[model samples]
Target: MTSPLDSRQILRRQLRQARKNLSNHAQLIAAQTLVARVDHYLSGQQTDKLKKVALYLANDGEISPHLLCEYFWQQSIATYLPVIQGKQLGFARYTADSMWQENSYGIKEPVTADYAPSRDLDLVFLPLVGFDSQGGRLGMGGGFYDRTFANKRPDASPQLIGLAHECQQVKSLPVESWDVPLQAIITPQQSILVS
Candidate 1:
């Protein structure tokens, strides 16, 4: 029998591999479809005050949000990428001409001194290894997003949304004490609003 922590680890590994197995063409289609789904979801919400938004560059098999970034750019909404600031995440504005530096994990981060804390952003789209319909998210086990947004509530200003491939959906996930609940989860096929 697997303990809850062990179960989570197993689920993480399985889901990570499931997504990682997607062909490059399939991944491209999923990303393109995601932009439409995300746009539709946001259109039905009150996004009048959205200014700064946070999203991640796709790593591993995480669905890319580059197209969604372009959608935001067209609307004049600034996008940011997470910078590893100690144990938590600091968001740096990402622009077409932004310079880059590699983080410890070899992920490229925007080379900028102007880092914004989580509270200032209007919306945040997170990358996940697995997610449940009830807003449970299994991250890369780094806990960066959890630590960065731990103090925020579901109805907080920076609405947390997890983005994933359809293959990453699970029946449920073991919720830990430190796990921060997402306000919603978005995939190429569906958008789940956590109530």
Candidate 2:
């Protein structure tokens, strides 16, 4: 009998491959489309109040945020990338001239000593393996984001958002107690604002 934990692991592998199967052209289109979707969401909110935003460097078929990073750069919003610190994540300012170092995961992180605590950022765009409409997020099984934002309230300073491709959404996800809910999930096609 497969336990929920085993089921979650199986689901993660399937979803990861599902995204990996996207053609390069399809991935590019999705990344471009995501910029517009996110832009539309920001239009309804108070933009001036949002100063810092943390984003991830795409890895293992995770939807790319590089284009969206450029869009934010144009708007003069400081972009940040997550740096692994012990068991959690720390945010470091990412810029055109930022130096890079690969973490254990082989993902590039800004090579800087300065880092802003997760709470100081205005927004955080998390990468996920799968997500459901009710704000549940299944991450890469590292537990980094969950531990980093464990204390974050539903309505906290740094609004947590998950970025993914349309194919990544599941009808329902097995939720774990340590899982942190997203305030919103943005895909190339649409945005799901969790209440």
Candidate 3:
């Protein structure tokens, strides 16, 4: 029998490969579709409270939220990017003029002192390798998001949303206790809300 850890690792590898195999055209279309879905969701929410948002720069073929960020900026919403802060994670405000520095993982991050505490943001969007219908998210084996958002309480200000390509969804995820479930997972196909 495969342990949960082993199962998760295998699933991650498969999903990562699936995403990386997307052609440039497919990726571009998927990203545009996802942005449209997110835009529709926000407009239908009936509130202007989701102004401050945190999201990551796409890496390893993960679905890109760059379009979403651009839309938010146009709408006057503040955009933030995650920074690797020691063993955990922190967020730095991102703008068109923000200077970017590459982290050890070769991912670009903002190196700035102006960072908001995680609890202050209205919404956080995370990239997922694999996700299930019930909100289980399999990340890149780095516990950054989970560790950073560990203190997220019920009805918190930052509603966690997982961003992924349609091919990344799985039947169900093998989740552990420490795994932080997402409030919603958005793909090019649809946006699923999980309780």
Where model 1 places Cα greater than 4 Å from the true spot, the runs are: none
C-alpha TM-score for every candidate = 0.96, 0.98, 0.96
Candidate 3 residue-pair clash tally: 0
Put down candidate 3 lDDT per residue, 99-182, tens digits, no spaces.
Answer: 989998999998778899999898899999998888888999989988988888758768898999989999988778888868
**RMSD to the native, candidate 1?**
1.1
lDDT of 2 by residue, 31-51 (tens): 999999999988999998888
Report per-prediction Cα RMSD to one decimal: 1.1, 0.8, 1.1
Residues 58-134 of candidate 1 have per-residue lDDT tens digits of 99989999999999999999899999989999999999999999999999999987777789999899999998888
**Candidate 3 CA-lDDT value:** 0.88
Which candidate has the top score in TM-score? Answer: 2
In candidate 2, stretches whose alpha carbon ends up further than 4 angstroms from where it belongs are none
- Model 1, C-alpha of 23: deviation from truth (Å): 0.7
